[model samples]
Target chain A: MNWLTWRQHRAQFLFGAATLAVITLFLVPSGLGIWHTFRSTGLAGCLAVTGRDCGDLASTFSDRYTGLQFTIPLFMILPALLGVFWGAPLVAREIEQGTHRLAWTQGLTRLRWMSTKVVTLVLATLAGAAVFAFLLSWWSRPFVAASDNRFSFGVFDLRGIVPVAYALFALAAGVAAGALIRRTVAAMGATLGAYVAVRTGIELWARPHYEAARTISYSFFGSGPHPGSGDWVLSTRTVDRAGHLLGNGQSLDFNVLHARCPDLPGPSSGFVSKAPIQACIQRLGIHLQATYQPGNRYWLFQGIESAIFVGLALGLLAFAVWWVRRKVA
Target chain B: MTTPAALTATALGKRYRGHWGLRDCSLEIPAGRISALVGPNGAGKTTLLHLATGLLAPTAGTIETLGRTPGEDPDLLPRIGFMAQDVPLYRSFRVREMLEFGRRTNPGRWDAELAQGRMDRASIDLDQRAGTLSGGQRAQVALALALAKRPELLLLDEPLAALDPLARREFLKALMEGAVDGEVTVVLSSHLLTDLERVCDHLVVLSGGRTQVAGDIEGLLEAHRVLTGPRRDVDRIEGVAAVVQQATTDRQSTLLVRTDGPIIDPAWSVHRVDLEELVLGYLGQPNATALPAPRLARTGAEVSR
Candidate 1:
């Protein structure tokens, strides 16, 4: 079984490894370049200390690595690519070409054949995703340290154990779709669509509710409670002294604001407006209330998301097994 | 000798989306016999072969091959070899590599010597890719792989459908040579009766998703007769047997019938029916009764006029 599994998937495994190597070769030099620029600009020491913001030098470093930043999102797409090319085609191609009859009729049972392929390819997907995440993490370290938005969707998802989990889910989805659809191209399309749907669902609806978000309200005209620089700020709203949550900007009436402050700066006004809106909000005892997931909860969210995806992946695999046994004929 | 059945299917049936592909099919193939399963294009021949090989699960009843439920236990896998329709092979691998695939996958039970010997005897190149091989070579490679498993029962579905006549003959010759001297029981399905008569001793014919006839080839041919006579009502003919099928032209009526009583009508001529004629006779008629055997009985040489 081991020998057969290897022979069957050796091409996909090699292609994944080669792609990882190419990505590593691309990241290492660019990473070093960022490190060198940070050190040469003397912002590395300044960033290491307290009460100093190296925003300018950080911006310069970011500007130098703009091309690298574009590639960071590409890391997020690798798992889906694995799903489409490696996972979808695994069983779909076999059934499509009718070689599954050959494979299933051997000394091994169809269940064993399917389980071995699924397990082996899943391990390979994890290893590939891990190597990719590690390389991308190394490349993005400087930018991550300089930015406060590391907990944002794009950055957090590609850095830790979650990418591996996502890879597992993607592969399982592909396999399930392939087993059901029995066509490689259609399965690949379904895998992509499902991956995107699940990712979007988690980012928009599920991730925020993983833990109750912490809200900090502060005095008017002041920065809201610091949930740490790396924390994910979900939303900031104005709250009155009566503790009523102000509707967001969409519901606020500009006409009422203009009527309240006839002397307010208009579009054609050349003068700079300092605090007209601030004064009005302060007069109403409006406070800045920021709701966010703290940086300390990053691992908690990661664990929750990984568990969700892994659970889904296992369910998809079970479905595939059932489909093969009961529905494939 | 009363050998045990290699395969026994009881009340076997398979239903597709809207209709049944095979229904109420029951058969028993004797051990150490070369059997042929014949049917038309839409008949249930492939469905029955698939059910026996465990490639498909019967929807209604049970089918057991080699004394075990087909595909129910992994241990039973090595005991039954199946070469599916089209002889599907891994085209990407070299011929030798394909053999190696069988070796690796079957593990401790694979017969490497038999595989290599068969390929060598066929003059198939070891280095040639399976996809690049001619149709006959591909079939040979597939057959060798199935035979190398040394299964007690081998189920082949339309194995010779795509081959040229010469290749077909050679392939059947190779199959018979390998099967005749052993305890191997082979069930081969094809629409062509001539391809089967030379190699197969047992027979089963499927039509309209039902088994029309089944028996030992000799017994089936011996039990059936084609009676030709002056134009007369077949229903009124004396000493007439079970009317399997009948055809009539302007002054002649020919009836293929299964009988236990002798034909005594002086106006009619009695002739032995061949395997092909018997199979075509049953296949052309729907709702045929349970045949005494799955093999079409071979017609005797002497005909009493």
Candidate 2:
């Protein structure tokens, strides 16, 4: 079985390795350029700041990280494409081409034949994912550490162990889809669709729960007293769980709001002071802050999620095996 | 007699939904016999081979290869080599790589020299990818893979359907040579009757998913006859037992008859039916019944008139 699988998929393994090497070679230089741009600019210091001002600087830093971080999404998508077209086709092509009948009639059982292919291709997918994860993580560490933006969470979350999970799930999904569909084009489309759905579902809805929760204040009002004499303070603000404002966890200062709203009457000019805006200020407490701090417990959360996907993958794989075993051409 | 039969199928039946692929098709092949499975398109020849080789499960029957049920016995798989009608070969694999894979996966001992010899005889290019090969070459490569395994029972579906006359002759010759000295039982399905007549001792003709006629080649030929004469003289014929096939016009009638004695009547002329004519008669008429054995000339000659 080992020898059969090795012979069957050696070409795919070589092609995958070559593709990974070429991508790394092409992207590493560009990645270094982004890193150099960060080191030369003073924006790196903004990452160390602990206030709303730092959040503003972090947005700027995110733009710098985008150059290198862009590869993370590409890595996530390209491997799945390859798995669908290349890995999925492994068995389908044999069956489509009529080679499976020849192999099945030989001494090897259908179960053993399919098992060899899945195991070999799975190992290859893991190796490719590992290399991609290592390179992407190593390159994007500086920028990811600086940004601290929630948007950057998608990028950082995908680069390291997350991509491995995605690739494994995609490979299994591709193989299962191919076995079920039995057509290359349909299998490829089904695999890509499933991959996108799983990635989107996990990133948008599931992974956030693994991190510290945070809430954003969507109200278009500033956190301060409204001065009388036709003065109204309007500002958009967001905050987190610690009663800290959105950009960074800092208490809102009404003195600054009053200064910005110069229309406020002199200190005693029939101004309501803090009374008029107190109701609006209390509404700020209604906003919930659940910040995702995945780094603190990366392994624990990753293990749980990986287990779930792995189980799904294995279950799908078993179904594919059974289908192939019982299938009649 | 002590040795086990190479292949056996008992009450073997296969049904897809309501359509019958094969039904009540039972056959037994003794050791070292080249059996030919002959049928027209969609006669379930390939389905029967698939069932016997364990590529497909029989819906309500048992198939035993080398004394073990094919589906339940894993060890029997390695001993039986099957080449489906749609010769399945990996497009990416070169001829050499395909043979290597066969030798590695097959439980039988690898015969590298034999494989190379067969490839050389077939004139197959070792470096060419299987997908790039021509149809005849693909068939040859498929045959080579099956032959390389040195299986106990070789079940080939339409192995010679795609080959040209020259390649077909060469492949059959190589196959016969391989089976000559071993206990190998070759059950090959082919539409080409000439090849079957040349190499096969046992012949089975399937029509409409059932075995219409199956027996030794000489026995089948001896039992059937083609009787042709004027249409008006048909009733004048005596000792006419059963008609396998009949074509009549205004003046002439050609009837394929099965009988055991001579047609002594002067009005009708008798001719011995060859394997081709017998098979054609059975295929031409679906409702043919058993006919009496034809009579042989008293001279004890091989050919009878």
Best by TM-score: 1
lDDT of 2 by residue, A1-329 (tens): 78777777677768788888898997689678767766666556654554425445556767645555455566658757756866578667776777778778877888888888888777778888888878877676666556432134456455657667667788888888888878777888888998888867876677556544433343334333211111111223445335555433344555533443455444456555664345434444423233334344555666666776677678877878888887644
Model 2 spans with C-alpha error above 4 angstroms: A1-4, A26-60, A66-69, A149-153, A208-299, B1-5, B123-125, B131-137, B228-241, B251-253, B260-268, B289-305
What does candidate 1's lDDT look like per residue over A1-329, in tens digits?
Answer: 77778877888889888988998898888778878887888877777786687888778877777766567568778888988988898789999999988888888788888888888998888888888878777777777777756777688888778988999999999999999999999999999999999999988999999999998877765665452257788887766667776655224444545554576676356653657776766666767677888887878888999999999999999999878876675
In terms of DockQ, the best-performing candidate is 1
Candidate 1 residue-wise lDDT, B1-305, digit = tens: 37898888888899998999998877788888889988899898888877776788889988888888876767788887889888888888999889998987787778898899889989999999899998888888999888888888888889899999999988998898677666889999999999899888998888888777778898878878899989887665566446777889999989887776788879889999999888887766665443653232322111111
Candidate 2, TM-score vs. the true structure? 0.80
In terms of docking quality, model 2 is medium
At residue B22, give the lDDT of candidate 2. 90
* CA shift of B97, model 2, Å: 2.5
Model 1 segments more than 4 A misplaced: A243-258, A261-281, B236-239, B293-305
Instruction: Point to the candidate with the largest lDDT.
Output: 1
lDDT of 2 by residue, B1-305 (tens): 33456777777889988899998776666667788888888888988888777778889878787888766788888777788886878888899888888788875565777778888877888999988998777877777777777788888899888778887887788778877867788898987788888899878888787766666677777767787777864543466555667888998888887665677877678888888888888778766633212312321222111
